[model samples]
Target: MTNPTSPRRHLPTSPFRTAAPPPAKRFAVGDRVSHDEFGLGRAISVEGDGTIAVLVDFGSRQERITAPFAKLFLL
Candidate 1:
């Protein structure tokens, strides 16, 4: 049985090339970004090469956005 927490591997001979996952988003300090909730902001600080956490200044307030960055988009 396979563990539910483990990712399933794609078969080499499989024809489903579209099943490949997209690359993780990368960010850097001083980069412009937008968020679903925060509107617009600029990266103030980044943790662990921007994959861990990012500090952003959204003018009205600052937020510490975390990984996966679901609502965050690079600009």
Candidate 2:
């Protein structure tokens, strides 16, 4: 059996080689954005350097979206 504490073999085609996560989404005030559920909206404000949440104003309502904005996309 292979030792669990041993160094991992680096395979050229291994998916684990790249262990970095994707870049976070950044939005500035007044920037236009689209959401999966909230639809289109304008960025009103951001909190915690945008790592906490983002306030967006939709025509019908407003929402505070959090980090790792999967449904939120830049327009």
Candidate 3:
């Protein structure tokens, strides 16, 4: 049974409505960069027509991180 005084339920939230931070644009392909967290790396690839993939060497290991060019600065 439903009560006439009961409050109405709200609709479920949508996940697609959320906004993402603008992509950074700093380096180009074949450019060198240094990250505070990743140390030193070189730009290997750019995808999504904006983001860049960096290959970093941390002495003991090498890793790759995709970030907007804006987040990285020219060295």
Candidate 4:
């Protein structure tokens, strides 16, 4: 059980979970990527620091996806 105040609690007894969270995902212009729902596409442009949102060209249509990018993945 956990609360909104602290979603993840790290214990000293656990060695594996002690490491910091994974680094943020980064995408460059023209970087090929795939989305769970958007099929496949190339990154058209990156908004802000590239972590806030990403504009992707998914063939038939373009969509703006924001973080945390749960479905977005680099190809």
> Best-fitting candidate, measured by lDDT?
1
| Candidate 2 similarity to native, TM-score | 0.71
Can you write out model 3's per-residue Cα lDDT over 42-66, one digit (the tens) per residue?
A: 6665555435565545456666666
Off by over 4 Å in 3: 1-23, 50-60, 68-71
List model 2 lDDT by residue over 1-75, tens digit each.
Answer: 999999776789886765667887888888899999989999999988766789999998989999889999999
Clashing pairs in 1: none
Deviation (Å) of 71 in candidate 4: 0.3
lDDT of each: 0.93, 0.88, 0.59, 0.90
Clashing pairs in 3: 24-68, 24-69, 24-70, 24-71, 25-69, 25-70, 26-69, 26-70
User: Whole-model lDDT for model 4 versus the true structure?
Assistant: 0.90
lDDT of 4 by residue, 6-72 (tens): 6576788986756677889888789999999989999999987788899999999999999888999
Candidate 1, residue 48: lDDT: 92
Error of 2 at 60 (Å): 1.1
Q: What does each candidate score in C-alpha RMSD? A: 5.2, 6.3, 9.5, 4.7
Q: Order of all candidates by TM-score, from best down to worst?
A: 1, 4, 2, 3
Candidate 1 CA-lDDT value: 0.93
TM-score of each: 0.76, 0.71, 0.41, 0.75
Q: Which stretches of candidate 1 lie over 4 Å from their true place?
A: 1-18
